[model samples]
Target: MPTHFIKLKPSAVDEYKAIHAAVWPGVLAALERAHIVDYSINHYPPLQLLIATMKYVGDDYDADMKKVAEDPETQKWWAATDGMQESFATGATGSGKDIPWWTEVEEVFRFEGTS
Candidate 1:
Protein backbone atom coordinates (compact mmCIF):
# COMPACT_ATOMS: atom_id res chain seq x y z
CA MET A 1 0.00 0.00 0.00
CA PRO A 2 1.08 3.57 -0.62
CA THR A 3 -0.21 6.94 0.43
CA HIS A 4 0.40 10.10 -1.53
CA PHE A 5 -0.37 13.78 -1.09
CA ILE A 6 -0.90 16.52 -3.59
CA LYS A 7 -2.37 19.98 -3.32
CA LEU A 8 -5.42 20.93 -5.31
CA LYS A 9 -5.74 24.35 -6.85
CA PRO A 10 -7.71 26.70 -4.60
CA SER A 11 -10.62 26.85 -7.00
CA ALA A 12 -10.71 23.33 -8.33
CA VAL A 13 -11.81 21.43 -5.28
CA ASP A 14 -15.50 21.11 -6.09
CA GLU A 15 -14.92 20.28 -9.72
CA TYR A 16 -12.35 17.69 -8.76
CA LYS A 17 -14.77 15.98 -6.41
CA ALA A 18 -17.55 16.14 -8.92
CA ILE A 19 -15.47 14.60 -11.64
CA HIS A 20 -14.27 11.77 -9.43
CA ALA A 21 -17.72 11.01 -8.11
CA ALA A 22 -18.52 9.41 -11.43
CA VAL A 23 -15.18 8.30 -12.72
CA TRP A 24 -15.35 6.86 -16.18
CA PRO A 25 -15.73 3.11 -16.35
CA GLY A 26 -12.78 2.88 -18.69
CA VAL A 27 -10.59 4.60 -16.15
CA LEU A 28 -11.66 2.15 -13.44
CA ALA A 29 -11.01 -0.79 -15.73
CA ALA A 30 -7.64 0.60 -16.65
CA LEU A 31 -6.61 0.81 -13.02
CA GLU A 32 -7.76 -2.74 -12.40
CA ARG A 33 -5.83 -3.96 -15.41
CA ALA A 34 -2.72 -2.34 -13.99
CA HIS A 35 -3.18 -4.14 -10.64
CA ILE A 36 -4.20 -1.08 -8.64
CA VAL A 37 -6.69 -1.96 -5.97
CA ASP A 38 -8.52 -0.31 -3.10
CA TYR A 39 -7.72 3.08 -4.55
CA SER A 40 -9.20 6.05 -2.82
CA ILE A 41 -8.84 9.80 -2.71
CA ASN A 42 -9.79 12.21 0.01
CA HIS A 43 -9.82 15.98 0.24
CA TYR A 44 -8.95 18.42 2.97
CA PRO A 45 -10.74 21.58 2.01
CA PRO A 46 -9.01 23.68 4.67
CA LEU A 47 -5.58 23.06 3.16
CA GLN A 48 -6.87 22.18 -0.32
CA LEU A 49 -4.95 18.95 -0.20
CA LEU A 50 -5.90 15.72 -1.93
CA ILE A 51 -4.77 12.50 -0.34
CA ALA A 52 -4.72 9.23 -2.23
CA THR A 53 -4.10 5.70 -1.06
CA MET A 54 -3.85 2.52 -3.09
CA LYS A 55 -2.36 -0.92 -3.14
CA TYR A 56 -0.25 -2.09 -6.03
CA VAL A 57 -0.50 -5.85 -6.36
CA GLY A 58 2.29 -6.20 -8.85
CA ASP A 59 5.93 -7.18 -8.77
CA ASP A 60 7.17 -4.50 -11.15
CA TYR A 61 6.00 -1.10 -10.04
CA ASP A 62 7.37 0.83 -13.00
CA ALA A 63 5.86 -1.59 -15.45
CA ASP A 64 2.47 -1.46 -13.78
CA MET A 65 2.54 2.33 -13.72
CA LYS A 66 3.64 2.48 -17.33
CA LYS A 67 0.71 0.28 -18.26
CA VAL A 68 -1.66 2.62 -16.51
CA ALA A 69 -0.05 5.71 -18.03
CA GLU A 70 -0.30 4.43 -21.57
CA ASP A 71 -4.01 3.71 -21.35
CA PRO A 72 -6.04 6.10 -23.49
CA GLU A 73 -8.66 6.67 -20.86
CA THR A 74 -6.05 7.37 -18.23
CA GLN A 75 -4.39 9.79 -20.58
CA LYS A 76 -7.69 11.59 -21.01
CA TRP A 77 -8.18 11.58 -17.27
CA TRP A 78 -4.78 13.18 -16.77
CA ALA A 79 -5.46 15.75 -19.44
CA ALA A 80 -8.55 16.79 -17.51
CA THR A 81 -6.78 16.71 -14.14
CA ASP A 82 -3.27 18.01 -14.83
CA GLY A 83 -4.40 21.60 -14.51
CA MET A 84 -6.50 21.13 -11.39
CA GLN A 85 -3.54 20.38 -9.15
CA GLU A 86 -1.05 22.74 -7.59
CA SER A 87 2.54 22.65 -8.72
CA PHE A 88 4.67 20.02 -7.00
CA ALA A 89 6.19 21.18 -3.75
CA THR A 90 7.92 17.92 -2.86
CA GLY A 91 9.71 17.02 -6.03
CA ALA A 92 11.23 13.58 -5.53
CA THR A 93 10.41 10.13 -4.22
CA GLY A 94 12.36 8.15 -1.62
CA SER A 95 14.11 6.53 -4.59
CA GLY A 96 15.47 9.98 -5.53
CA LYS A 97 13.41 10.16 -8.69
CA ASP A 98 11.64 13.37 -9.59
CA ILE A 99 8.03 12.35 -10.12
CA PRO A 100 5.56 14.57 -11.86
CA TRP A 101 2.93 14.97 -9.15
CA TRP A 102 1.70 13.37 -5.92
CA THR A 103 4.48 13.10 -3.38
CA GLU A 104 4.64 9.71 -1.68
CA VAL A 105 4.55 9.88 2.11
CA GLU A 106 6.35 7.44 4.31
CA GLU A 107 4.14 5.51 6.71
CA VAL A 108 5.59 5.72 10.19
CA PHE A 109 3.22 3.24 11.80
CA ARG A 110 0.01 1.32 11.32
CA PHE A 111 -2.37 -0.87 13.31
CA GLU A 112 -4.55 -3.66 12.01
CA GLY A 113 -7.18 -4.44 14.59
CA THR A 114 -7.39 -8.01 15.85
CA SER A 115 -10.41 -9.89 14.60
Candidate 2:
Protein backbone atom coordinates (compact mmCIF):
# COMPACT_ATOMS: atom_id res chain seq x y z
CA MET A 1 0.00 0.00 0.00
CA PRO A 2 1.24 3.47 -0.96
CA THR A 3 0.03 6.78 0.41
CA HIS A 4 -0.77 9.66 -1.92
CA PHE A 5 -0.84 13.33 -0.96
CA ILE A 6 -2.31 16.32 -2.77
CA LYS A 7 -2.64 20.06 -2.06
CA LEU A 8 -5.29 22.50 -3.16
CA LYS A 9 -7.27 25.56 -2.10
CA PRO A 10 -10.98 25.77 -2.54
CA SER A 11 -12.59 29.15 -3.13
CA ALA A 12 -14.09 29.23 0.37
CA VAL A 13 -13.82 27.05 3.44
CA ASP A 14 -17.54 27.13 4.18
CA GLU A 15 -18.45 26.24 0.64
CA TYR A 16 -15.83 23.49 0.49
CA LYS A 17 -16.89 22.05 3.83
CA ALA A 18 -20.53 22.07 2.83
CA ILE A 19 -19.75 20.23 -0.40
CA HIS A 20 -17.68 17.50 1.22
CA ALA A 21 -20.31 17.13 3.94
CA ALA A 22 -22.45 15.40 1.36
CA VAL A 23 -20.06 13.96 -1.19
CA TRP A 24 -21.75 12.18 -4.03
CA PRO A 25 -22.38 8.54 -3.21
CA GLY A 26 -21.31 7.37 -6.65
CA VAL A 27 -17.95 9.09 -6.45
CA LEU A 28 -17.32 7.54 -3.05
CA ALA A 29 -18.20 4.09 -4.35
CA ALA A 30 -16.06 4.54 -7.44
CA LEU A 31 -13.03 5.38 -5.31
CA GLU A 32 -13.54 2.28 -3.23
CA ARG A 33 -13.89 0.15 -6.32
CA ALA A 34 -10.62 1.56 -7.62
CA HIS A 35 -8.72 0.36 -4.53
CA ILE A 36 -8.37 3.78 -2.91
CA VAL A 37 -8.49 3.66 0.88
CA ASP A 38 -7.90 5.77 3.95
CA TYR A 39 -8.98 8.93 2.18
CA SER A 40 -8.67 11.95 4.44
CA ILE A 41 -8.62 15.73 4.13
CA ASN A 42 -7.07 18.36 6.38
CA HIS A 43 -7.44 22.11 6.10
CA TYR A 44 -5.31 25.10 7.05
CA PRO A 45 -7.75 27.39 8.82
CA PRO A 46 -8.24 30.94 7.46
CA LEU A 47 -5.84 30.14 4.60
CA GLN A 48 -8.33 27.63 3.20
CA LEU A 49 -5.57 25.35 1.90
CA LEU A 50 -6.56 21.70 1.82
CA ILE A 51 -4.33 18.65 1.97
CA ALA A 52 -5.78 15.35 0.83
CA THR A 53 -4.33 11.95 1.55
CA MET A 54 -5.28 8.53 0.27
CA LYS A 55 -3.76 5.08 0.02
CA TYR A 56 -3.46 3.53 -3.41
CA VAL A 57 -3.00 -0.20 -3.76
CA GLY A 58 -2.90 -0.24 -7.53
CA ASP A 59 0.31 -0.67 -9.50
CA ASP A 60 -0.53 1.81 -12.25
CA TYR A 61 -1.34 5.31 -11.06
CA ASP A 62 -2.29 6.71 -14.45
CA ALA A 63 -4.49 3.73 -15.29
CA ASP A 64 -6.35 3.93 -12.01
CA MET A 65 -6.87 7.67 -12.48
CA LYS A 66 -8.12 7.10 -16.00
CA LYS A 67 -10.74 4.67 -14.72
CA VAL A 68 -11.95 7.20 -12.20
CA ALA A 69 -12.03 9.97 -14.78
CA GLU A 70 -14.04 7.91 -17.26
CA ASP A 71 -16.88 7.54 -14.79
CA PRO A 72 -19.97 9.37 -16.01
CA GLU A 73 -21.35 10.26 -12.61
CA THR A 74 -17.97 11.48 -11.48
CA GLN A 75 -17.66 13.67 -14.58
CA LYS A 76 -21.03 15.22 -13.82
CA TRP A 77 -19.98 15.81 -10.22
CA TRP A 78 -16.85 17.61 -11.40
CA ALA A 79 -18.92 19.77 -13.68
CA ALA A 80 -20.93 21.00 -10.72
CA THR A 81 -17.94 21.97 -8.55
CA ASP A 82 -15.35 22.92 -11.20
CA GLY A 83 -15.97 26.64 -10.82
CA MET A 84 -15.62 26.59 -7.04
CA GLN A 85 -11.89 25.86 -7.09
CA GLU A 86 -8.91 28.21 -7.18
CA SER A 87 -6.34 26.42 -9.30
CA PHE A 88 -2.67 26.76 -8.47
CA ALA A 89 -1.76 26.70 -12.14
CA THR A 90 -2.97 28.75 -15.11
CA GLY A 91 -5.19 27.78 -18.09
CA ALA A 92 -8.70 26.35 -17.90
CA THR A 93 -7.73 22.68 -17.88
CA GLY A 94 -10.83 21.69 -15.93
CA SER A 95 -10.46 19.25 -13.02
CA GLY A 96 -7.85 16.59 -12.29
CA LYS A 97 -5.36 17.73 -14.89
CA ASP A 98 -1.61 17.31 -14.46
CA ILE A 99 -1.73 21.06 -13.87
CA PRO A 100 -4.68 21.89 -11.66
CA TRP A 101 -5.59 23.34 -8.30
CA TRP A 102 -4.78 20.00 -6.66
CA THR A 103 -1.14 19.04 -7.09
CA GLU A 104 0.08 15.55 -6.22
CA VAL A 105 2.85 14.99 -3.72
CA GLU A 106 5.31 12.15 -3.20
CA GLU A 107 4.74 10.15 -0.03
CA VAL A 108 7.62 9.47 2.38
CA PHE A 109 6.19 7.23 5.08
CA ARG A 110 2.93 5.96 6.60
CA PHE A 111 1.71 3.80 9.48
CA GLU A 112 -1.52 1.84 9.64
CA GLY A 113 -3.66 1.63 12.80
CA THR A 114 -5.76 -1.30 13.89
CA SER A 115 -9.37 -0.51 14.67
Candidate 3:
Protein backbone atom coordinates (compact mmCIF):
# COMPACT_ATOMS: atom_id res chain seq x y z
CA MET A 1 0.00 0.00 0.00
CA PRO A 2 1.21 3.48 -0.83
CA THR A 3 -0.08 6.55 0.93
CA HIS A 4 0.18 10.05 -0.42
CA PHE A 5 -0.56 13.44 1.05
CA ILE A 6 -1.53 16.65 -0.68
CA LYS A 7 -3.24 19.88 0.20
CA LEU A 8 -6.44 21.09 -1.39
CA LYS A 9 -7.03 24.72 -2.04
CA PRO A 10 -9.47 25.78 0.65
CA SER A 11 -11.95 26.92 -1.94
CA ALA A 12 -11.86 23.56 -3.68
CA VAL A 13 -12.97 21.28 -0.88
CA ASP A 14 -16.64 20.97 -1.76
CA GLU A 15 -16.08 20.77 -5.47
CA TYR A 16 -13.37 18.21 -5.04
CA LYS A 17 -15.60 16.00 -2.93
CA ALA A 18 -18.41 16.36 -5.43
CA ILE A 19 -16.13 15.39 -8.27
CA HIS A 20 -14.83 12.30 -6.51
CA ALA A 21 -18.32 11.29 -5.49
CA ALA A 22 -18.90 10.35 -9.09
CA VAL A 23 -15.55 9.80 -10.75
CA TRP A 24 -15.63 9.28 -14.49
CA PRO A 25 -16.28 5.69 -15.52
CA GLY A 26 -13.39 5.68 -17.94
CA VAL A 27 -10.98 6.88 -15.27
CA LEU A 28 -12.21 4.24 -12.85
CA ALA A 29 -11.80 1.55 -15.45
CA ALA A 30 -8.30 2.69 -16.26
CA LEU A 31 -7.32 2.61 -12.60
CA GLU A 32 -8.69 -0.90 -12.25
CA ARG A 33 -6.82 -1.98 -15.33
CA ALA A 34 -3.67 -0.59 -13.83
CA HIS A 35 -4.12 -2.91 -10.84
CA ILE A 36 -4.71 -0.09 -8.40
CA VAL A 37 -7.16 -1.25 -5.77
CA ASP A 38 -8.41 -0.51 -2.27
CA TYR A 39 -8.10 3.15 -2.96
CA SER A 40 -9.50 5.82 -0.73
CA ILE A 41 -9.05 9.54 -0.23
CA ASN A 42 -9.94 11.47 2.88
CA HIS A 43 -10.22 15.18 3.39
CA TYR A 44 -9.54 17.28 6.45
CA PRO A 45 -11.52 20.46 6.24
CA PRO A 46 -9.69 22.20 9.02
CA LEU A 47 -6.34 22.00 7.25
CA GLN A 48 -7.59 21.50 3.72
CA LEU A 49 -5.59 18.33 3.46
CA LEU A 50 -6.29 15.35 1.25
CA ILE A 51 -4.79 11.98 2.09
CA ALA A 52 -4.97 9.15 -0.37
CA THR A 53 -3.98 5.51 -0.10
CA MET A 54 -4.07 2.64 -2.54
CA LYS A 55 -2.70 -0.84 -3.01
CA TYR A 56 -0.83 -1.61 -6.19
CA VAL A 57 -1.02 -5.29 -7.01
CA GLY A 58 0.76 -5.38 -10.36
CA ASP A 59 4.11 -7.03 -10.76
CA ASP A 60 5.62 -4.02 -12.50
CA TYR A 61 4.99 -0.93 -10.45
CA ASP A 62 6.55 1.60 -12.77
CA ALA A 63 4.93 0.15 -15.86
CA ASP A 64 1.52 0.01 -14.23
CA MET A 65 1.89 3.61 -13.04
CA LYS A 66 2.97 4.67 -16.49
CA LYS A 67 -0.06 2.95 -17.92
CA VAL A 68 -2.27 4.93 -15.59
CA ALA A 69 -0.47 8.15 -16.43
CA GLU A 70 -0.94 7.48 -20.13
CA ASP A 71 -4.66 6.94 -19.84
CA PRO A 72 -6.40 9.79 -21.67
CA GLU A 73 -9.17 9.93 -19.13
CA THR A 74 -6.70 10.14 -16.27
CA GLN A 75 -4.90 12.93 -17.97
CA LYS A 76 -8.17 14.76 -18.41
CA TRP A 77 -9.06 14.19 -14.81
CA TRP A 78 -5.72 15.63 -13.75
CA ALA A 79 -6.38 18.69 -15.83
CA ALA A 80 -9.56 19.33 -13.88
CA THR A 81 -8.06 18.62 -10.48
CA ASP A 82 -4.65 20.17 -10.81
CA GLY A 83 -5.82 23.68 -10.14
CA MET A 84 -7.67 22.53 -7.07
CA GLN A 85 -4.56 21.15 -5.36
CA GLU A 86 -1.35 22.58 -3.90
CA SER A 87 1.75 20.48 -4.35
CA PHE A 88 3.59 19.45 -1.18
CA ALA A 89 6.97 19.03 -2.77
CA THR A 90 9.98 20.20 -0.73
CA GLY A 91 12.61 18.84 -3.14
CA ALA A 92 13.52 16.16 -0.60
CA THR A 93 12.37 13.13 -2.57
CA GLY A 94 15.19 10.60 -2.94
CA SER A 95 14.76 10.78 -6.70
CA GLY A 96 16.04 14.38 -6.38
CA LYS A 97 13.09 15.60 -8.35
CA ASP A 98 10.06 17.35 -6.99
CA ILE A 99 6.83 15.41 -6.99
CA PRO A 100 4.34 17.40 -9.03
CA TRP A 101 1.26 16.43 -7.07
CA TRP A 102 0.91 14.19 -4.05
CA THR A 103 3.94 13.44 -1.91
CA GLU A 104 4.52 9.90 -0.79
CA VAL A 105 4.46 9.41 3.00
CA GLU A 106 6.87 7.00 4.57
CA GLU A 107 5.22 4.49 6.84
CA VAL A 108 7.03 4.26 10.13
CA PHE A 109 4.68 1.82 11.80
CA ARG A 110 1.50 -0.17 11.28
CA PHE A 111 -0.74 -1.50 14.00
CA GLU A 112 -1.65 -4.76 12.26
CA GLY A 113 1.93 -5.97 12.76
CA THR A 114 2.08 -7.25 9.18
CA SER A 115 1.21 -6.33 5.66
Highest TM-score scorer:
3
* Candidate 3 residue 81 C-alpha distance from true site, Å: 0.7
How far residue 76's Cα lies from its native spot in candidate 2, in Å, is 1.7
Candidate 3 per-residue lDDT, tens place, 58-97, comes to: 8997788778778888888888887788877864332212
* TM-score between candidate 1 and the true structure: 0.86
| lDDT on C-alpha atoms for all candidate structures | 0.80, 0.69, 0.81
Candidate 1 pairs with clashing backbones: none
| Best-to-worst ranking by TM-score | 3, 1, 2
Of candidates 2 and 1, the better by lDDT: 1
On lDDT, the leading prediction is 3
- Model 1 poorest ten-residue lDDT run: 89-98
In candidate 2 the C-alpha lDDT for residue 37 amounts to 75
Q: Write the per-residue lDDT of candidate 1 for residues 15-100, one digit (tens) a residue.
A: 89899999999989988987887899988889888899998898887788777778888888887886788655555332112465
Give lDDT tens digits, candidate 2, residues 29-66: 87887788768877765555566777788778678877
Comparing 1 with 3 on lDDT, the higher-scoring candidate is 3
